[model samples]
Target: METVLIEHFKKARRLFRILLVLALLCTVCIGIAYISIFLYAKIAGPPTLTVPQTAIFYSSNGKVLDELHNGQKRYWVPLESVSDNIKEATLAVEDKRFYDHNGFDIKRIGGAIVADIKAMSKVQGASTITQQYARNLFLEHDKTWTRKFQEALYTIRLEFNYDKDKIFEGYLNTIYYGHGAYGVEAASKTYFNKKAKDLTLSEASMLAGIPKGPTYYSPLLHEENAKERQRIILNLLVDQGKISQKEADKAFVTPLFYAKKAQDEANAKKQDASYFMSAALSQLTNELGITEAMIHSNGLRIYTTLDIDVQKKAEEAMNTVMNKDSDIQTAFVAMDPKTGAVKALIGGRDYKKSPFNRATQAVRQPGSTMKPFLYYAALADGFTESTAMQSEETTFTLDDGVSTYKPSNYNSYYANNPITLAQAIALSDNIYAVKTHLFIGEHRLVETAKSLGVSTPLKQVPSLALGTSPVRVIDMVNAYGIFANGGKEISPTFIKRIETAGGDMVYEAPQEKKQIVDKRLAFLTTHLMTGMFQKELNGYTTVTGKPILKYLSRDYAGKSGTTPTDSWMIGYTPQLVSGVWVGYDQGKQIERVEEKAYAKKMWALFMEDALEGKKKQAFKAPKGLVSVNINPETGDIATKSCSKKYKAYYLTGTQPTTYCRDKGVSEEKNQAPQKQKEQDGFFHRLRDWF
Candidate 1:
């Protein structure tokens, strides 16, 4: 019995020593951990809080236009902006001991380990709010020891540098709440169509439940599952002493209204300004050398040149005038002539049905709109507004001598007499245009178009003068802007500036100008285009713009073009330049007369409406141009006695040397043709030929 007592004493002594060693080892381990954390805190610096955020786009008027993001949309709001209910509900559901623990809850983690061991799987999480935020900001959601270890280190680092409120705010902002929503604010807006600060207890509880298993608890997808999870969260809130039992019961039974319905879900995929936003994003990525992935992830603030009011006017005009049932499509673009800013643009009638940006993408024949470039070339080639050409039917022998080309006027009607450049333009006289195109050489028109910013490829064919080559509507608008802006070349600009999420400047557009067209020639060509609306310029045909003249309240210089498959009207005032194209996408003939009329009528309506409440300014003539009264029939300086005369613009040395011999000419000769042309209404019959 003594020997047994000795052996028991020895065993007890060994057990005590083992306990003492363990205590010392644990103390050393704790010291080492503390030292490592201190070193890491010294090295890691401040918390970056880097997370993907939604990029916002603002209009010129400082209104939010749209937003872009990755699959998950996040809008960061300060802790002050989040409702107390949301904070309470999130704490109850996600981490109850959030403020009590530094970065990890020892008791909760021990409980979670026991629970997982009982389940024989890693089926429980004990992450505190700070740990989750660290994982969200720095680590991926991989179920591995390495990820967990990294998450722990990051959590310690975060706790060391940031206060509890900052870490909480970051967690609230970065946590994924499902359905393409990455934060409390985005979730609130997505589910309730309200700001996060406006969420009630019921809505906050509903949103809070989604973060655990986003897809499983999403109110939008699984309503019953979401309700059950929300009820659980409300009970947790009540048990945590954050809310009363009556409040929990009331929240659980409250009738909830979701922001999105089945149809709304479909419609949300396509919103207003989809086309314009797409174009701006394209420019941002392609032209500005910014990658789309960066744009999606980085919180960028893009300020665009879009005038929201003008954009609305453009849409209203298109819808108001267009036949909604018709399949014929149209594209429109409006710009500030001086600055080259694209204030308004529409790629197609409906962006959802089709995303083809016809304004910048479609290359359709410009028809007679090409004449301005051609006429501009003529003016540079020493051809005045009074330059005369025979408009009778003619076949041109090609340089090869074996080939001949025949071009006819609209409706095969011709002046059958010599008509001045101004009259030819007003009539859209194809015969005279082709004759002049050949006389000056087709290469001249090609050169002129390029100088005016036409980037599309062109063949030096006689029809080039008549705009047979296909060109983009946007390019045409910019080209017309040169004429409207007194010959200064301007690029079509969308984004005015870009800024980082932190308000650092990324890019600011430079207001640059290049003189491509001579100011004198641009003014002279613009002057000739205005003859389209003047009744005095009528000769073999009524002016092409005569049909839309009654719709105009301000002076505008423009041209109209027609092809078998396309109808175009591009015009501008000094302040704005806009273009419209109407046609079938398949290049089918525009058979309907009303469809043919759509371009001009739409242009008239949009310009009038868009420029409303703004100053009505006239086109300013340059210093060297002189205005002269000329006889439309004679292309000669007009006398007071001349029966019909109109003001024409000429360069100082380019005016006609002869005066009109109208004193002895018969009244029938002078007045009869003008009356006949108006009565015929060449543009009224444009339906048959346009």
Candidate 2:
């Protein structure tokens, strides 16, 4: 028996020794495995620290017009930019021992393990702010064991690479808050109508509790639930000793404005600036050849030609004239004539409900606004301001061979006599316009429009002179800009320069000048169009412009177009050019007189404020143009004997040389065919040609 007992004891001792050896080997293997993970974590780097940053837009005068994002409005401000109130409140509720632990809280994890087990799922996450940030930055947020293990590895990497402040800031920024707000700054603004740094303790505590379940705690959709969440957060803040019980009580009753009011305020503040952002981003993507991901990730700083004051004035102008009851909507765009810098753009009356950009996209008939192009084509074809056109009833068989159309004046008040080309344009006489259009040919007008930047296709018909072609508002503005800038064709550009977030210059618009129209012809046309100023009434009133001169008293030339549905008023000074359209976004007629006049009134109101405080400038005539007083009755060089005359600008040598005599007749010096041919003048040749 004693021998058997000794043998059993020895066998048990041997088994114990073997078990101890296996345990030591297992410990070494586990240690190596841990070292391998640590090495990999150190090598993998800080899990792509780049978060989506808000793209900033700057106006021409270096003002921040907006901060926008494609998907989420996240403004990644500095760590110091975050208020201590929010920091303490978030730490109190989300991770009470965030700074006390290295990356993970063992005690929280243990408690979460029991709670999750009891709930039969991952109903509780003991994730420290670091672990939460790791999951957000690098790992997929799955509650499975594999994702949690991977999150642990990334958490170690995060703690090793970044300090507490960076981890907390990164966590705050990367964590999602509802209502499309991605970061604390955005969430603060989303909830409280203020910046993150300006958030009060109560606001901070309420926001800090939101990330737990944004939908569940949303004060916008669930006010009572959000109030309960806010109460819990206040209690947490008091328990953490960040605030007193008295403070908690005060914060419990804090009046909280939900995300809706904040959004409304932001929309009211942004106004039409978001539309500009949308347009600018489209251009930036095309210009830089970068993707939307690149725009958000690379942190591009878009410098645009938008003028803040002008944009505001435009918004104010639209608001003043437009109301909810008003059926018509308006599109307005203002640009710099010299550089083609688009200073202001209001695509529609409101951008939120309807984002369709009317200024750049919508195409509508231009009515008499397109008459300038026809007259420009005529001038290019050697027709001068003195060229006379008959406003009598005229009929032309359609080139289609199946239809005949008769064109008349706007009010059907035809002069029944000859009117010079200058008077033809100023008075907007469609009869004389069509007569001159057929005389010069429609193809010439199309060529003129294309040269001066009318991109829309124009049909070759007599009605083409009367703006039969549908045109974008930008098209009219750019085309008229040619006449404003001494006949140089310029493409309207919105972006002034572009840069990376680090201020590396990517693009700057080149000053390109392509002379598409002759300087003399442009000056001649401008002079004739400005004839609205030449008329003097009983009182001291300016006589130039399409009733636009009544408000825009300075020297500017433009045209008014009226289709059955669209009304366009596009004009330009030497400094600025603007186009205003009043109509519905959908194809609908503006039948009311006041709605139609809104286009012109919007133009005058915007220009009246735009040109304010700036020097009142005049357009200087290009060389080779002469200002001469000519007879409106006979298109001849006016003498004192001529009772009715106005100062007219004419192409050099195109000025009428004959003198007006008695009975409103012209006195020719000779009667021979060659002398009669010489005395016939430009107007008579054009008249006889048709």
Measured by TM-score, the strongest candidate is 1
List pairs with backbone clashes in candidate 1: none
How many collisions per candidate?
0, 4
Displacement of the residue 469 alpha carbon in candidate 2, Å = 2.0
RMSD of 2: 4.9
Residue 431 CA displacement from its true place in model 1, Å: 2.9
TM-score of candidate 1 versus the correct structure, residues matched by position = 0.87
lDDT of 1 by residue, 155-219 (tens): 98898889999999999999998878899999888888889999999999999999998999988
lDDT of 2 at 580: 92
Global Cα lDDT for candidate 2: 0.79
For candidate 2, the per-residue lDDT at 687 reads: 54
> Which 10 residues in a row give candidate 2 its minimum summed lDDT?
536-545
Candidate 2 residue 677 Cα shift, in angstroms, is: 9.6
